[model samples]
Each structure stands twice: as structure tokens, then as C-alpha cells.
Target chain A: MNILVLVKQVPDSEALVQVKGEGSGVEVEDRYTLNFFDSLAVEEALQIKEQTGAGTVTVLSLGGQKAIEALRTAIAMGAAEAVLLEDPAFENGDEYATAKALAAAAKGMEWDMILCGKEAFDDSSGIVGPLLAEFLGIPLVTTVVKLDFISEEQAVVVEREIEGGKEVIKAPLPVLLSAQKGLNEPRVASVMGVMKAMQTEIKKLDLAAVGLSQSEVGKAGSKEEILRYHRPPERPPVTMIQGEATEVVRQVVALLKDEAKIL
Target chain B: MAGDVWVFAEYQAGKIRKTSLEVLSKGRELAEQLGSGLGVLLLGSGVDGLAQELTAYADTVYYGDNPLLEKYNNDVYYQIIAALAEKEKPHILLAGATFLARDLFPRLAGRLKTGIAVDCLSLEMGDDGSLIARRPLFGGKVLADVVCREGRPQIALVRPNTFSLPDVQSPAQGKVLPLDVTVDTSQVKLEVLDVTRMAKERLDLTEAEIIVTGGRGMKGAENFQLLDDLADVLGATVGATRGVVDNGWRTHDDQVGKSGKTVSPKLYFAVGLSGAIHHVMGMNTSKVVVAINKDPQAPIFQYADYGVLGDLFEIVPLLTETLKKEI
Candidate 1:
């Protein structure tokens, strides 16, 4: 089994994001890390390779310089190779265009399975994975929580979440799966692994290297144009209801009825 | 670009989901604005009954009936929806951002080579007849307005409670129209083996009008019963903070935070949890926030509209009792 995982660098969940006054974009905190679900994806791929003991695990990410850190982190975890798809032309692409470039990259390599984070922390679109599957003409089963080998080279059965329930499904090889939360507990890299990752050269590929064009990726290739970003309406100060428990409860309820009028 | 507005009316566990109706209500408003017809797409086996319910809102109900579509098979549903979009060429396609829609609509848009916005907070008609969808990013801290400059049927998946349920039309106008869909069994790849419903089915947080959430101060897993009792009185759902869920006091499914689900309930009751930024990110979209913590300085008070300082045990039951009488 040849396993390839797609990872992304995103603002840390705890990172404070402030919308700029010009409405161009928000100024995000400098903190960045591998997306939570993508870490699970990388972990699941490494575990699959470890269990099969045959196929190689390669981690791939599409971003600027910071994306390499995500790849290095994945490599430190256990991936054998890393590829960074970075180029000015590939920047600001929507899910459709991003999938187009990633599919081109996948065509340049040989892999039996592809795994991606269910959604990124920054965008949370959850569209790129399925779009990549469609672009590759492969079947996709998303939000997968469990996987079992039916045949090492042929097929696998997976369990995915649904509304108030879960569904167990089977899919053939050369398929794409999006890792949901609870898939597995990710492991931290050892000091040796981190040192080895830093020494290893990260392969960088531009749009041309992936056989993509300027009009086929990034903002040019994007279908939806983001006009601007703005902060949500500011909330009011809290009305503290002090005194006895009963009195405080009464005040809160009365405020909910009179002021908020939501009850 | 004169075309009709299409809505994917999702039927789950035998009834049309309320979120579908919510989207349809908004779709109706959009259709009226564009001076176009409104239609609903129903895909399932023996769903004519559900289609009838949809007619109260939509003008035409287009349903595709097949055993293969009995349970949502991704490939089959995608093929049929794409084929319909190809044939009908509707101006806009709307769906409720349920788990299934979130899983399928983006894939359909890719196949159709169109633009789509998910988890949209609001949808507006641009001057150029394009779809302007404003959606939250980086959780609910910021909002971005997006538009599809060039796309046949602009697609959007709206969050569940963003729009109110429409009043049922006195005389239902929708007429059921069976779509032409041929399922090539050979083309279908994935096969579902089994589906298990949850033992205790609570109101989905995204759709709940009110949520009463407990935190570390709830004490333990058993103490969640207080939240449930409050929720019962308020006709709300129960949710938990990350601390409570991480401590195994509640399942991750019941969790609301940066790591869990984002909710926009009309009224939110915060019990004993510090107003951590991660937790606030998920529920700050709420209309009215009520925080009950012993510590007045807890961070949640900053975001909450009303804060009741007291022990949760004494306060929760008393509040429930007080509301039971006042309401």
C-alpha cells in the first residue's frame, strides 16, 4: 500500500484573529501548526504503512514557506518523504483550484490511497478532499473514523460518522478518505526525529512542476472571490446578577425575558 | 440568466429535516426576489410523503426514487444531482448545511464546475445576478463576503438556524415531478454495510434554539443531569465544554469549542465554565448568552449578556423552577 497524506498549515486554534480596519483581511496571530485533522491523517497513514510494512508514506502540503514546517513536522512524526507545492500562482486558490493542482501533483506520483484532513482550521471548508477525489476520478468516503484491511492490495472497510449515527462502508484501493476527529491519537516526534527532519531537504514544486498554469490555480483559478473580511458585531457588557441564589436566578430570568426577549 | 431556485430537501429517518425547511424558506425569499420559481429536490426510496410536506413551501417537488438512493450512496446521489443541475440549469442551488450536505454539495459543485459557499450566515442577491454569500471564517470571529463571478447555478449550503421556518401555505402549490435518473450499478463503488443510530438522540446543537451547557463546575458525568433538567424546562439541548468532555464527563459529540461543533442558538446558558476563547469561539454567535458561575471574574462573563453569580447546584434548579412558573 502506497499512502499519501495531505496536510495544511493553519492558524493555531487558540491564535487570536483580528479583522483589519481596511477590510482586506484579518491579522492572524503568528502561531501556526499542522491542522488538527491533518495530523490525524498523517498519523493514520503512518500507522497503515507500519501495519502493512510494505508501502511508503509521503506527506504533501500546499502553501508558502510555513507549509514546509507542517511537512517537516509530519516527517518528524514518521513520513519518509515530503513535498511542498508552493508558488505565487498557486496562492489564494479556492477548493476547486486547489484540488486541481493537488490532483496534478498526485498524477506525478504513484499512490494507492490518499488521506486528507476533514477540514482546515482556517477555512473549514471541508470541500478540497472530495474535490480532489473527483479531480482524480477516485471514489471518496469522508469523515472516516475507523478503517480495517480487507485485502492489503485490493480494498478496505471503513466506518464514518453520520447524523446521530455512523455507517460502515467498503471502498476499493486508489481511493481518498478524510480523517475526522477520534480517528486516532497522534504521537509527538522524538528529538532524533526532529534533528533528522531539519537535516532532510524538503522538495519544492511550483505550478509548472505540477503541470498547472497561472489561470488554473490560485486566485485566477478560483471560482468564488472573497470581497473582504470583517469582524462580527461586538457583544454588550455583562449584567451581573449578584445577591442570593434565588434572587440572582430571578434577575437573570427577568433580564432574559425583558432585555433579550429570546425566551 | 433567468432560472429557477432549487433546494435539496433532505429526508432523514423518514421525515424532512427542519434545516431543509429552513433553507427552503430562505430559498423562497430568494426566488421571490429573482422573480423565479422555487423547486425542491428529494432523493430517497418511498419519499413521496415527505415530498408532500415540501409542497407547502416549494412550487415543484423533483424527486428521484431508487433503492440505491434509499441510503445516501455518495456516487449515486452526486450523479443524480449533477444530472438534474445539468438538465434544469437552475440559477441557484441551496441546501441545509447538515453533515450529509456538507459531505455532498461541494463534491457536486466540483463536478458541475461551479462555485459554492458552505456554512453561510447569510445570502444576498448581487446587483449582477450573482450569489453573495457571507460566511464565518476562523470560527465565528470573522465573516467574509464571497461571490461567484461566473457560474451557472451558484450553490450555497446554509447553516441550519440562520433562517426561520416558513409558515405552511394554506393551499399547497408544489406538484411532484419525478426526475429521470438511471443508476449504472457498475459505476457505484462504495457499499454501505451497516448504519447504527445513537442510543440517546438529542437535538442537534446547530439546530437547537436554546442550549444549556455544563462545564468543569458540573462536577462529574452524573452531574450533567442538572443541565438536562434545565434543558428540559427550557425546551433546550445540553452541551459541554472542552474541559468537561476531555475529562470524559461528556462525549465529544456533546462538546462545543474550537475543537468541536460551532453553534448559533438563540439563547445559550453557560454553567460553571470559564469563558475560554476556544469555547467562546463556538457559541458567541448566540443571540443572548447567560452565564452562571460562582466566580464573577470568570472570562465567560465578558461575552455573556447576563451573569448570575452562585453555586450551579443551587442556581440551576432554582432558575429552572423560576422559569417554570414565569414562563
Candidate 2:
């Protein structure tokens, strides 16, 4: 079994996002890391490969030159190899075009299953995995928490998180599953693994190599164009309450009833 | 067979979810703005009766009743919705940014080769007959104003609690139209083995109106009972900071921060948690924020509407007791 783990690199969760150029763009500090959820995907893919003993986990990502760091991190963890889809044309694409490019690249690879985070921390659209499945005409199960492979049946059963609880689903191989929270406790890379990953060569693919033209992969291929970005407005000043616990409680309850009127 | 504004209603547990109604209400507003008809699509088994709740808001309620839809099959729902959308060519389509919608609408848009914005905070009509949707990206720190620069049936999945439910109309003038859809068994590959929703009364954080959240300051798993007690009294759902969740004091479902669920509730309580930017990004849209922390310098106090600088162990029980007496 060959598993493809789709990953993304994003600003550190603790990093402050700054909007620049009159909303033309936003900039974050240099701090960067693999998206928290995508790490779960990496962990799940690695666990599957280790337990199955007959499969390979190759991490794939689309981004600028920095995204290679995320792939290397995945390799440092346990992936056998990594591929970086980096090209000027692939930048600024929305979910539709993103899946289009990924599907284009995926067509050339042999895989039994594709895994990715349910949503990336930056966009939080949760669209690519399902869109990729649609582009490939395969089934997709999202927010997956548990997965088991039925090798003999050539199918898999997955437990997916739903609105209220969970659903156990059965689908054929070559399906796509998006990792959700509680999927697994991701493993940290060891010193030896990190050293090995530092020397590994990563394969890079551009629009032409993937057989996608300039129009269908990036900003030109995107459906929705971001008009602008505005920093969220700050909330009003807080009304501080001090004194004894009883008095503070009284003030809060009264405030909720009269001023805030939310209670 | 036609409507300019279409809302895909989500029905679960025998009732239409509140987010669907909220989106319907917004759809009604958009429909009025365009002076066009509003239609709602309801697809599920035994959901025909739920159309009555939607009829007040939509001019027409289009329903496709089938057993295959009893539990949401992503493929079946997509098949049914995509075919109808192709035939009718709706100008705008809206659905709640839900577990179902987040998964379904993107695929729907992909198949239709159109544009969709998910987890939007607001939606408006653009000058070009397009939908202008404001969404928070990079978590809640940034708000983006975007539009589907080209396509028809511009799709958007709006976050719940962003809009209010419209008042039900007396003598409902809306009509119900049943759809003729056949279940294509060949396309259905995913099958459900079992479903477990442990507690019916416990609400999902996204849909909860009031939330009482704990953080690392809660100390340990045993202390979350204080929050549970307070939550029990106020009928509010409990949430946690990622730190507490990672510390094993709470489940990921109870986590409300970046990397967890983004919640927009009416009233939010930040208890024993020094607000981190990552945590605040998730619940920043809350209408009323109340912070309780012994430390006066906690950053959470900045974003809070009401701040009580005191020990949560003492303040929480007293607040609950006081609230109970006052009510």
C-alpha cells in the first residue's frame, strides 16, 4: 500500500498575523511550523505504514520554497520520502484549483489512500481533501478519528466525527480521509531521524511537470479572488470588578442582567 | 423549480438545526434585497414535516424524501443537490457552516466548477450580482472580504450564530415542492456501521448559545467539576483551552482555541485561563465575554466585557449561587 499524506506549512499558532499593504496582503513573523492538524495526518500516515509493514508513506505539499521544511519534518518523523509541489503558478490558488493541481500530480503516483488534515490552520476551508476526491472520482470520509484496513476485502472502515458524535463508515481502498482532532497523538522526531532527514533529497514538481498549465493551477485558476483583508476590530474596553467574591459575583450578575443583558 | 436565493437546510435528530434556520433567515433577507423568490432544499427521510418550519422563511421548500438520506451520505447528498442546482441554476446558494456543509459544499462547488466560501461571518450582495462574503482566515485574527468574481450559484457556508432567526409567520404563504430523485446505488460506496452520540442534551460548541470555558488555571481534571457545576446551573456548554485539553483535563471537543473549534456564542466565560492570542482567535466573535481570573494582568481581561479579578474556585460557586438566587 502506498499512502500519500497531503501536508501544509503555516504560521506558528502563537505568531501574530499582520495585515499589510492596505489589505493587499498579510504578513506573519518568521516563526513557522507544520499545521497542527496536518501533523496529525502525518502521524496517522506513519502509524499506518509502520503497522502495515508493507506500505510506504510519502508526504506531499504545495507551497513556496519554505514548504520543503514541512516535508522534511514529516520525513524526520517517519515518512519514507517527500514531494514538494512548488511553482510560481501554484501560488494564490483557491480550493478548486488546489485540488485540481493535487489531483494532476496524484494521477502520476501509485496510492491506495490519500490523507490530509480536515482543514488547514491558515484557510480553515476543509475543502481540498474532498475536492481532490471529487477530482479523482473517489470516495471521501472527513473528520476521521479511527481507521482500520481490511486488506482481504480491499476496503477500509473509518470512524468519523459528526455533529453530535461519530459514525463508522466502510469504503473501498483508494479513498481520501481527512484527519480530525483526537485522530492520534503525533510522534516527535528523534535526533537520528532528524539527521537522516537533513540529508534526504526532495523531488520538486512545477505546473508543467504536473501537466497543469498556468491558468488552471494558481491565481488564474482560482474561483474566488480575495478583494482585501481587514484586521478584526478590537472589542470594547472591559469593566473590571474587584473586591470580595460576593460583591464581585453580585456586580457580574447584575451586569449580565442589566448592562450586557445576555444572561 | 426556480428561486434566486436558495438555502440548503440541514435536518438532524428529527428537527432542523438552528444554524439552518439562521441561514434561512439571512437568505430571506438576501431574497428580499433582490426582490426574488427564496427556496429551501430539504433532503432526508421523514423530513417532510420539517419543511413547515422553513416555509415561513422561504417562498418554496423543495424536499426530496428518501431512506438513503436518513443518514447523510456525502455522495447521495451531492448527487441530489448537484443535479437540482444544474437544472435550476440558482443565483445564490447558502448553507450553514456545519460538519455536513463544510464537507459537502466544497465537493458540490468542485463538481459544478463554481466558487464557495466556507465558515463565513457575513454575506452580502455585490454590485455585479455576485455574493460578497466576509470570512475569518488565519483563524479569527483576520477578516477577509471576498467574492466569487465570476460564477452563478455563488455558494457560501455561513457560521452559525452570525444571524438571528426570523419570526415565524402566521398563515404561512410558502409552498412545498417534492423532488423526484432516484437513489443511484452504484455511486454509494460508504456505508455506516454504527453511530454513537452519547448524550442528547450535551450540545456541540459551535451551536451552543452560551459557553463556560476553562483553561490551564483549572489546575487538574478534578477541578473541571467546578466548571461543570457552573455550566449545569447556567445551562451553558463547557469549553477548554488547548492547554487544558492537552493536559488531559478535557477532551478535544471541549477545546475552544486555534486548532480546535471556532465558536460564536452569545455569552462566553473565560475562567481561570489567561487568554492567549491563539485561544482568543477561536471565540473572539462572542457577543459578551466575561473573564474570571485571580491575576489582574491576565490578557483575557483585555478582551472581556466583564472581568472579575478573583479566584475562580471562590468566585465560580458564588456566581452560580448568586445567579440561581437572582433567577
**TM-score for each candidate, following the candidate numbering:** 0.97, 0.97
DockQ, per model, reads 0.77, 0.80
Error of 1 at B132 (Å): 0.7
| Candidate 1 C-alpha lDDT tens digits along A73-160 | 9999988989989899998888888988999999998799999988898888899999999889888988888988666448989988
**TM-score for chain A as predicted in candidate 2:** 0.97
lDDT of 2 by residue, B41-115 (tens): 999888778887678778889999877778888878999999989999888999999888887888899888899
Taking the tens digit of each residue's C-alpha lDDT, what string does model 1 give over B172-289? 9888898777977777888888888777556688788999999999999998988888888888989999899889998777888777778889999999999898799789888889
TM-score of 1: 0.97
Best by lDDT: 2
Best by DockQ: 2
* Model 1 lDDT, full chain set: 0.87
RMSD (CA, Å), each prediction: 1.5, 1.4
